[model samples]
Target chain A: MAALLPITHLLWDTWRGNLTVNPLQDWTFRTGDWALRLLVASLACTPIATIFGFKQASSVRRALGLYGFGYAVVHFFIFIGVDYRFAFDLIWDDLATKRYILVGLVALLIFMPLAITSTRAWMKRLGRQWKQLHKLTYIAVPLAVVHYIWLVKADLRDPLLYATIVAVLLLLRLPWVRTQISKLKYRRVFQKL
Target chain B: MAPKKTIMKIYSSEITPEQTYYAQSQSRRQFFKTAGLVASGALLSACAPSTPSTVDPAPTAIKPEKPVTAGQTDELGDAITQYDAISNYNNFYEFTTDKQGVAQMSAGFVSSPWKVQVGGLVNNPKTFDIDDLRKIAPIERIYRMRCVEAWSMVIPWSGFTLSNLLKQVDPKSEAKYVRFETLLDSNRFPGQRDRSFPWPYTEGLRLDEAMHDLTLLATGIYGKPLLPQNGAPIRLVVPWKYGFKSIKSIVKIDLVAEQPTSLWMKSGPSEYGFYSNVNPEVSHPRWSQSSERRIGEMARRRTLLFNGYADQVASLYAGMDLRKNY
Candidate 1:
């Protein structure tokens, strides 16, 4: 958090003059994009840890999850505090009428349980069920992308790029990739079979 | 040399001693008293409510001789006043796209020294100064201005009918269209330097529409000389059209035989039509125009066709297909 100040200040100064996008919208989009990227990064950690045979990579999962939540919180606050001016009626109307808003809210709601149970105590309590519950991120991520695509009016280029990145990350989890990994395993049980 | 130096030193010492003594005695007392009085005066002024004299007076120089008639001042005076403030503070994108930026930057415009050049297909090619144009004729009409963005405002504008002004210009037999140009000054208007919009903002109307009684060459709003933000010096006010059709800070009025290209229409033809009327049924591809929030209304409300002036200006487009033209 302390290290992020300089980068945040640099972004603020750079966008002070540009009026093509409003400052609030720019901040929301950047934060939301960063959250989506962090979610993809967290998903990559499990795959990377398994491939390299490193136990240390698994420990960073909690930090990555918290970072994604932090960005989501920033994005949520910006929408409520600045964009809607904390008006409940307007927010209610947006949530009801706007498809993108509804999708985003649902994604956030799904992530809330995962984020709350990210701690070691909750993990120890839930034990086997914890991993199953955290898998909801895979669903949450695609919903987030859909929320973004529906929000944009005409420009699909940025959203398309995000979709492509997400697709590649999800493809790494396919059965073919898992089968290749199994063939390369050093365990003798495979040879006996 | 020793005698002269000693005399000069004695003179400087004498002046310093006398000044120090005065500062230590009467001057210090006087200074403290004056400071105390000033502080108390400031305290008293801060405690008092601002009276009329203390408040900045509304610009009195441009007040119209004829007061607002009873009929014109309807039950919506408060709403009209709020609309006046919003409309007068506008940065109609045609002049400059930035809403608040244009207000401050347009101060450098020399409105009084300006002239409108009327020529092209007109029988008499003549330039009229601001005063000459003001004296031609004056009419006060309250009309609703609806923006392409779906915000609306009801403004009481003081101006001569565009038809009356056109009569003075005397259109030639071949004249079929009228094009308007806003003054271009990059130094005065920083928005002019912005490439988001093309320079020398232009709008056009058909000759018949230009000559319509509802079309006005406005000089004032709320019975006062227009502020720079509201297109001071001169602006066009076409009541039935979307606000963009009413060009601002006009410098040239050209009557032409061919249809002139408008700025927005040239940029995005499908989004902005040449005949940009205030038709709620005709929605812009980007957003619905089925409703508009009046500037000061507590809640967003439905927009009226022709901005509720169908009785006055609907006949102009009676036989034509509005959807196709739109």
Candidate 2:
């Protein structure tokens, strides 16, 4: 429902003939927003699962991560297809001159490995290493935020909001949060005894 | 579905005798029209070769205006192709930033009722209607229009020189710049309410630039009344500068003593400058201006200096630092 809202808004604007600013810019911004939302949703899954004692909500984490990957791919392609117009020369020029585009390309490249290894079979094969490799999201999230902040000129409000959300989510996974989880587990074990 | 079928059946059967008679009569009328056309065709064939052919000569047979002078061949001058001339029209951004949208929405403008208010530092502030302005001397000049967006067009525009028009207004010695304001009717222009950019577009030129011979208060393009999107009634066309320098659909031409605030500059000072000349060396902050894709020209064609009218306008910017002016 949350993803549908922004898509509907974009449709309304397009129907109203108000898509004057390059469609690529609109596509990139919307995809980036959706990717951030998905990442936030993935982080919220564990909290919701613990609070409600419903393991089903945690099952959505994989889907949310994949959604983030989907949107990131869309954002990357929109930049290449519309902005660069598939001109290799122009793309090369932009990569050289625009540091933000370079950082964004790098962030997308780093996310590609995680996206490819996201399947259940690969997860099972990697076993314990799967959890460690997937922790790259911690790095990828902030890098993506920085990429967005660098791209925008004189408008830090939206990027700052995303950064704040990602920061809070990451902070929620600190040693204190682990100690609290351990205390809760100990209380549950003692209560069962 | 059954009810709809019944409704359609009744609608078709409702036709009375009088309606049927009228329908039959209409077909008969059409037959007579066809017969008349056939008879005219036959008559034309019969008279085709006889009586030395009294039919009127082709309208194009009329004597050409400005006949070629002695020893002057049509091939002597550098000819701009008709396709290039037609397609290279610099789109006015008032209706919409989309090049085609400007062309579409301009049709709604009623240019006949147009009036221009000339005020500010001018001694004789006056308003001139479309007819009043047309009565003045008209000169046709073919010049290139370069857009700040890195596209360019060459156009043959017809209008009186701005210097000649300015002489009537008699600007005070303090008048150092001329600012033009486009018509601001949101009802007619849907793009006015767009928040993406400012509306009631404004542009300005230095006093000397305004008074230059290359500057014109244009009313027509391609020898026709200016298209609505092309700044009908009147617009300022500075051939050597970017297209935005030529403000369109001008409602007011203010002879300001001070440097007038320009719309683009006020919105983003770094991106737009006051004197937006066509200099390849000085690139726009967001994009390069070294080359422009001339609309409808082959993509590989090189951009020209002063957009290929350098001989005419090169002297205008001579001794001036183009980078600073740009």
Candidate 3:
């Protein structure tokens, strides 16, 4: 429901002509924005589970990852179809000439294998190898962020916000950092009692 | 009596051409007068709808303007961009970064009580009232405006040649460049608060470029005085160069011997240049300049050198390397 809200709002906005002067650009930007937000959200699950002992965090992890990938697909489709008019010459030129677009494409490719093997059936079949394969998300997540950072002109606020969120989430993955956060919370509860 | 036909004829005779003329006279310009009401109909994200929900039925005290000398041209057959599209889709960053919001912000602005300071390296330094500057016999020119961001528009602007104005000021022999500054008013123009760019946006042109016949200090468009968001009172309009070269809400004019660096050049020198002439061969460091998406149109058209004014302005840069300067 959360993942679909942005597209739903955009559909209403686009239909009502309530978007920016360049609606096409705004539509593409908003969709990609949600995709990054959810991708980073999915990564935050592991840290939440370690620090807060939230058992349910793991349940939503796969769903969030899948939702992010879905939006990324839509974002790429908008760029090529509406923005570029599916012109092969322009697409070819963009891939070669624009570094950011190339980076975005590579990031998408990295996430594809992980998405394909996301189901429990494929995960159990691959066994321990699944754990190693899923580690690619760490690389893919940062690459997606880089793609967005490069895509923007001057305003770095949006991209920087995400970069900082992803940084904090990554830092929490450290055993010492997670133990520190856990101890802080435990101390707060003890003081209350 | 003559039944249905007679009644229809009688009603048509009563309303007729005089009613149409009366309506025209009662309004300043069809668009500017109703601009405050625009937001109620359509809204864009960056800009508030400048139009009020209810329009004033009566016209203000502003008098009818004299028609500018219409310079005959072989029409490019390009459709005049829709008035709303031209006005709504703007980069008047002084109001806000979002082009849509300026319309609302500018409707409250008083452009009539305006003055332009022209001094610097000139023999005659003068500050003309907005009304007096409008008096210097005008001309109509339809020019294509190509933005650095790969969007384009065709505008019919009303103004006399910039050379005519420059001549009146009489630039001194040492003056090789002409620099312009936008009005500095943080109270009205919120964009000044943005530390990302230097305040009171500045732009410059070579003295020769400023003196070109095609260069105009546009005062109006669409047979009406320019709307505030559209750079009311007076603004520079260099049709051949990128649109940023044609600065808006101009307050001061300075002539200098050295090439004056502009706002964009200061922000990202690699991306913007001192000479921002439209050249297809040289792309902006960030995006392709080969094609531009016309604001209301779908397909992007290939951009032309000097925005297709090469025959007139090409010789101005004949010997210089465009790529280096670009």
C-alpha lDDT (0 to 100) for residue B50 of candidate 3: 51
Question: How would you order the candidates by lDDT, starting with the best?
Answer: 3, 1, 2
Looking at model 1 chain B, report the run of 10 residues with the lowest lDDT sum: B5-14
- Scored by DockQ, the top model is 3
After superposition on all C-alphas, the RMSD of every candidate to the true structure, in Å, is 18.0, 15.2, 11.1
Task: State which docking tier applies to candidate 1.
Answer: incorrect
lDDT of each: 0.69, 0.67, 0.78
Model 3, span A44-127: residue lDDT tens = 988778777897997899999999999999999898888778777756765776778888999899989989999999999999
User: Each model's DockQ?
Assistant: 0.11, 0.11, 0.23
- State which candidate has the highest TM-score: 3
* lDDT string, candidate 2, B1-326, tens digits: 12221111111122122222233346755644454555555657877655323543322222121131210111113222232234324355556655645655766687778889988998898888988888786666656677766655545577788888788899998899998898888777777777656778899988888897678898876556777777887888886777887888888888998887787777778667888777766755433355554553433123456655566566767898877766
TM-score of chain A of 2: 0.81
**Colliding residue pairs in candidate 1:** none
Candidate that beats the other on DockQ, 1 or 3, i.e. the better one: 3
Q: Indicate whether candidate 1 or candidate 3 has the larger lDDT.
A: 3
TM-score of chain A of each: 0.81, 0.81, 0.90
Writing each residue's lDDT as its tens digit, candidate 1 over B1-72 gives 122211111111112121222233466556445545554556557767644344322233112112323313
Q: Candidate 1: TM-score?
A: 0.58
DockQ of predicted candidate 3? 0.23
